[model samples]
Target: MNKVYHLSSCNTCQKILKELNLPASFETQDIKEEEITKEQLEEMEALAGSYEALFSRRARLYRERELNKKELSEADYKELILDHYTFLKRPVILNNDEIFIGNSKKTVAAAKAAVHG
Candidate 1:
């Protein structure tokens, strides 16, 4: 299903969701409210190619935990994201089975074209 995984409390997420101009048929999951399921994450991983691609290295917890100091494998990235919602890159958009990760200008632009056009 086409969806957007986002944190409702994050302004960047809110702004992207708006900017994407998603249709009513496209579901939006607030990761903060309903945590991502293993199957769901795995599906994203399948589309995204790796768990690390979905992980947000910029999260406060990532720095607080000093994960950068350690070498993290794909499994580690998957486990970390499943453990905490913050690990997910904000506004992970899945459209027509094509995944758009993070809030970068290129990603948002791509998602906009995919969803609306």
Candidate 2:
């Protein structure tokens, strides 16, 4: 199944759902409710090439909490992400062999290709 990791009320998540047009094959998991695991975060971090890329830098919590990527340790990152799932970016789609960070035309197309190709 195509698992879309996202926040429940995020407009970007909704937009991805709309663009996907395949509810049957996809499953949505709200990041807040889903509770991102350390293992999963590690996997995403490895693929993303940096922990910062996994975070939603634009969020108020990010600024309020002062989550500067340069200052965080691996363990610190895990705790922060665990404490606030919203700290991570929206619509982190995980499928068989691909990880998509956000909703965009390029990302959607790549996801489609990764799923169908």
Candidate 3:
């Protein structure tokens, strides 16, 4: 499966998608428009190892809700991500069995290579 889960309004995601230049075979899912389901998140977690790996602590809601002050568990991470779309990191790309999560330089580079190569 060649799928990219991203937020349409995020600049980083837009830039990455533009850089990737994916073909028609690639599928794009706008998380804001279509919220991620539990099954989808579970699939991602299965490839990513854990929900924590897929969760983004940099979201504005995280700080606004003071989630940083509290200790979060695996379940909390999953719940937060499911409840709010922003809790997820931008641009989660799934290329076959390889899953890339986040917008870091290295992650984006690797994702691009996977799709382009």
Write down the worst ten-residue block by lDDT for model 2: 68-77
Top candidate on TM-score is 1
Per-residue alpha-carbon lDDT of model 2 for 19-57, expressed as tens digits?
766547777778787788887788777777777677666
By summed lDDT, which 10 consecutive residues of candidate 1 come out lowest? Answer: 88-97
Model 1, span 32-72: residue lDDT tens: 99999999999999999999999999989998999989999
How does each model score on lDDT?
0.94, 0.74, 0.93
Tell me each candidate's TM-score. Answer: 0.98, 0.78, 0.97
Off by over 4 Å in 2: 68-70
Please list the Cα RMSD from the true structure of every candidate, rounded to 1 decimal place.
0.6, 2.5, 0.7
Ranking by TM-score: 1, 3, 2
Clashing pairs in 3: none
Residue 103 local lDDT, model 1 = 94
Candidate 3 has what TM-score? Answer: 0.97
